[model samples]
Target: FFWGFLAGFLEIVPYVGTTIGGILPVFYMLMVSDTLWQPLAVIGLYILVQQIEGNIISPNIMGPSIKINPMFIILGLFVGGIVWGISGMILALPILAVSKEIFRSFDATEPLSYLMENGLARKKDVFLERFDHEKHRILRLFFEKREEGE
Candidate 1:
């Protein structure tokens, strides 16, 4: 139940959304608990749950649909924190996501095309020469299987 709620809440913001949402529970436990050890325990529990989510859960559940770069998210949080306080930090990445989608629409394509070409779409293309002939062997195996199937 707690995990479910955290997952849903984290879905709203891109990038560090999960981390941002994870902080709330830790702070709440620290603030409400009587003993120092209780807060420490809650923090440990949060880290454990986050590890599980990152390794097993997120890979299977949110594998392809929710893919966002971590750098952008960090920038969002920093800018948002600077601008509008904690709430801004929370909202910045989501707003960027929504705006990015909107800008990608056909109606806004011209301006967005230039922006994307200049900003996000720039990437280094590295060429590598392989010594092993494994790729050809793998292709031949696949072709043989397809031919056999037919």
Candidate 2:
């Protein structure tokens, strides 16, 4: 019951919190029970819950509200984990969301919000813009060389 409440509260933290919530119950079960199957069953239940949450619940909630790339979230989660273990991973998504909101205020930083966007269009725009910039540089270099030769 305590673990359930913790899980409910920390559900706001994204995958890391859900994961911790799921694992803690298993540990609790193991400590209180003699049967190995009890803990194993809890693990299985957690896995099922995780699968459902990932495929269904999260997309429904996070797709609109969080509005960030899942891959980026995973990357942030990993970076947080490396830097400060479970706690960092748990906090990373909300921190990232807040950061995205802050960056949204300025025109210069507006482009960065698209970096976190889940859609391919924004990413394509950024890539195409960079390609155009580089192409212009290369063309300028070639023209300069030709002019020098002439």
Of the candidates shown, which would achieve the greatest lDDT relative to the real structure? 2
**Model 1: runs farther than 4 Å from truth?**
1-46, 54-63, 106-150
Model 2 lDDT tens row, 1-150:
687688778888756677788888888899999999999998898788778978999789878988888888998899999998988887889988988887677544655566776885756966557544433343454455454556
In order, what lDDT does every prediction score? 0.61, 0.77
Best by TM-score: 2
Give per-residue CA lDDT, model 1, range 92-115, as digits (tens).
757766765665564323233223
lDDT of 2 at 103: 67
What lDDT would candidate 1 get against the real structure?
0.61
Error of 1 at 32 (Å): 17
Which residue ranges in model 2 land beyond 4 Å of their true spot? Answer: 1-47, 122-150
Error of 2 at 91 (Å): 0.9
